[model samples]
Target: MRVRKLTFAALAIATALSLTACNDEDLTGQADPSSTSTGSSAPDDAGSDGSGGSDEEGGKGTVAGTGSNENGEIGKCRTDELEITASDATIGGDTEGTVAVEFKNGAGRDCALAAYAGVDLGTDSGMISAERAGEPVDTTILKDGKSIFFGVTYPMNDSGGSGVRVTSLVVTPPDETKSVSIEWPGEATLPVTDGGGSSVKVGPMGSAGQGEG
Candidate 1:
């Protein structure tokens, strides 16, 4: 009976050790439901790439229609904004004479002129339109308080009896309908028939030195 008690005690101790090991394993293996996760869920930074470098580098490039000009807008010049005048331009080159016409920008803003200015010589009979001379290669910008120039060419008549007598000039800006009238600088008689072609012709608009005179 003493030997049986000894074996029972040994078996009880072994069972108690096995239960303690199982409780330890259960405590370590199970995850806590209330605790936060270790993995990140935040969004990536906008300026940084994954390699820790920035995505953007420099300033913006130039945009369309925004040039070096002030006010950043360019449009056709209007007739009402101009102060038109005429003067006697020196005629020296090929053969014929030309009248220098200048357009001053009194409008406090900027504008542009392309192609020829429409010109008409006012006579007692009717209005005679002058023909356009050259093709427009560039758009002339008339800045605030600036002036643009062009020329009106005509055949110089040694014998003055053939052509219509012109007393005033009715001028119109490019791509404009309304007209402005200025007195003719000198007496001119533009012929109605000059070798079956138009007698009067106007050239393209230009800056100061590039004018016809």
Candidate 2:
């Protein structure tokens, strides 16, 4: 009987030790080093790739039709926002006459003007063939209230004594459809011949204060 009691006591003590070990482990809350984290491992609002925010929300990048002049530099100049003017016509020679043309940006932003300005002597005469006089000019950027200038040289005399009758000059800015008209100076007439293959020449556009041709 005493031996049976000793065995029972030993068993009870062993069971108590096992329970205590389990309770200690539970209290410590140890985690396996190799186990992956179960809590949401997803990325935050910035996105995992790192490119975040939008111009629409006033964040990084340029907003459409607004922002710094550098950002708007790609936008073409609009006709409605441009102010076109022509200097007094000058007779360079019996065959050639030159006129200085200026385009001012009246819009409240910066814009790009490129290529050659389309020139028309009259409504029915169609567009006159023109070529750039010199090397290609750098792309012009016109800021608000700024202006760019170029020269247009045309024939002053046709095969006959009569010169090209130009009542008004129609001008179109580069890369634009809308055109503006300036009344031809009464003293100047192009010497180009009727049905002749002669062509007018235009110089590269440069900033204001550049000498006129």
Candidate 3:
């Protein structure tokens, strides 16, 4: 009878030990929620056009001029009332291959221009939109003869000597949808291709004080 009681006691202890081991295993095997990944990988063609793989992909909303629509006192500059022109800008007393685009109020009235203007380069493939460089500054008040300027920075050193020749520029004034296609001032060319490092950055709009040249 004592042997039977000892055997029963050993069986109960073995069962208790087995359950404790299973509980420990369950606690250790649980996955840490913080380390688990959530999102999928980015597409292979991401940032191919130098758009940084965001909402600016395929050149849509590349130069998001959001701050331009805030001023309602002087009214936004209309596309037809503004005369747009481009010229080779001399950066730091030397032409560092930058283009200065000028906007003048030719409609014999006063208008306002704020934030970055939408810009795109005319290439062989299609229009390559420019990315916004810096934040918007003060509103540019354009009188009949006054002008506002923005600079376009691009890679100009064509090592292969067969760069993409930029023939024209598609410009959209602040708060306007109608774009104007102006011939690229001077023979401007980029050293990169369409899908390859073909990046173009545009500064915000400002008067002559904002480094127009």
Clashing pairs in 1: none
The lDDT of model 2 is 0.68
Write one digit per residue (lDDT tens) for candidate 3, span 1-213: 999999999999999999999999877666443233222223334545444755455345533444344433677789999888888775554434678888878878788787889999998756789888866677777777677788877766447686777778999997889999998874566766547544788888852234432
Off by over 4 Å in 3: 1-72, 91-96, 193-198, 207-213
Q: What C-alpha lDDT do the candidate models reach, one value each?
A: 0.74, 0.68, 0.74
Q: How many backbone clashes does candidate 2 have?
A: 3
Q: For model 3, which pairs clash?
A: none
Which candidate tops lDDT?
1
Better of 1 and 2 by lDDT: 1
TM-score of each: 0.62, 0.62, 0.58
The C-alpha RMSD in Å for every predicted model, in order, reads 6.2, 6.2, 22.9
Q: For each candidate, how many residue pairs have backbone atoms clashing (under 3 Å)?
A: 0, 3, 0
Assess the local accuracy of residue 61 in candidate 2 as a C-alpha lDDT between 0 and 100: 43
Could you arrange the candidates by lDDT from highest to lowest? 1, 3, 2
Collision pairs in model 2: 155-191, 156-191, 157-191
State how far residue 208 of model 2 sits from its true place (Å). Answer: 9.0
